[model samples]
Target: MFKKKYLALVLLPLLLLLLAISFLGQAGATTSSKSSAPLAAGVQDIVDRGVLRVGVKQDLPNFGYRDPENMQYTGMEIEIAKKVAAELGVKIEFTPVTAQTRGALLDNGQLDMVIATFTITDERKELYNFTTPYYTDAVGFLVRKDSKIASNWEALDGMTIGVTQGSIQWGLLEEIAAEKGIHFNFRELGSNSEVVVALAARRVDAFSIDQSILSAFLGKSNQLLDIQYKPSEYGIVTKKSNTELANYLDQLVQNWNKDGSLQTIYNKFGLTPVTEISD
Candidate 1:
């Protein structure tokens, strides 16, 4: 009985050791398999799954709005994403997100990328990777030409302003107004079109949003209103770990600029193409 007990105790440790080695080997194999995948580092797993997950906003006109008649997404950024997906040889699965949640979606691995009309800023660069600017734009104000408010930035004082939620332009406009001693009340809207609707209804005195976006709205609505835009640039965004993908996109943008693809896209919408900077 003692011999039997001793034998069992000796075999138990060996069995456990074998199991530990087996687990370690499996872990090592998993790591190697992941490393050998075909997609970009940190992104192979997603590509291997055969879908490029994208976060886009359907609310923003001319950038990501969906076609009302067909319920298909057709906008400037959407076109750009489609091209990228083609190059990657993967299908695109778009996830709708608001300005407030876009960054969160990118960070959480829920999205492989974001090509929405996301403006690049110094602070945002810390949290995500930015492709080289594919387009330039600016924050601009929209007001009815017949309205009593001032036409330019200097003229806006004591007038209520309308801006969309989760827009950097909204916060910037408020600060500028406050600094200028302009007591403007800022109204938050869901989309740029809503902002224009509010202004037309006199629900708000003025609206501030991206200048190109405002241009698209004006072109479509043909409303009698004066429009203006200040200069800025826009870029694609990805999670910080997606450096390779971001760089790839930057290169693609460069090619687009050289071959007139970017200009062609802009021209299709009657938008003036901004010159690309080589640096």
Candidate 2:
């Protein structure tokens, strides 16, 4: 009986030793798999399937627009999407998406990613992850060169202001005015271009948009005599569950900022570079 008990004790230790080795091996395998996982699963899936599905706007000028000459989508946002595809080693397939469908498309997996000029907001951050800022601009009050309305936020009170409907610019303008205890007569325009035309035709006293966009428009038309920008910035949008992809994009944006890629894009379209709005 004693001999049997001793043998059993020895064999029990051996069994435990083997079990420990097996656990260690399984842990190592798991670690290896994790380390070897693709950087962006969505991107990898698209690459493996031999296509990169991107959602882009067909009307936003300088961001995403179809070229009338060739009917090919092209712009700063398109260029950024191309860069991401090049990094992932995939062919890009763009699908026309408006602001309304952008979230749903990404949610349903119809689009791998969206490179549209999507503004990051706390409200949007609930459903989507936002990368580091790709471009920076602010809400600017655009008035005719000869208009006498106040250009600055504090200076304008009880004056009718115009902004594009469903835009951050419109929201920010209202928020800032409320915070400052100023009342603004606000008009929601159908589109950004319409806001500009309204300002030019004296339909509205002012128009609000990002500084870079406002600058580009004024630079092209030479119509802006007085422009005042209230500090803000832009960011890339992605689904919140896509944390890995979001981090990758944020890193890429930081690298791009460091390497002057952002500035280069701005310069290509004849706009001034912006740095360090929110940091």
RMSD of each: 12.3, 9.2
Which portions of model 1 miss their true places by more than 4 Å? Answer: 1-39, 148-150, 178-183, 219-229, 274-279
The TM-score measured for candidate 2 stands at 0.73
lDDT (tens digit, per residue) of candidate 1 on 1-279: 999999999999999999999999999999999996565665565567789888887866667877779878867788788888887788998888877788999988899888877888888899889888877876666677667554455566667888887787766766666676666677899877788889889898767776666666564323323434444677888899888878777888889879988878776656664443221
TM-score of predicted structure 1: 0.74
| Candidate 2 global CA lDDT score | 0.73
Question: What are the TM-scores, per candidate, against the unseen true structure?
Answer: 0.74, 0.73
User: What lDDT does candidate 1 reach at residue 218?
Assistant: 62
lDDT of each: 0.75, 0.73
Q: How displaced is residue 279 in candidate 2, in Å?
A: 19
Residue-level lDDT of model 2, residues 89-163, one tens digit each, is 878899987656788998987876787767778888898888887876555666766765554555677777777
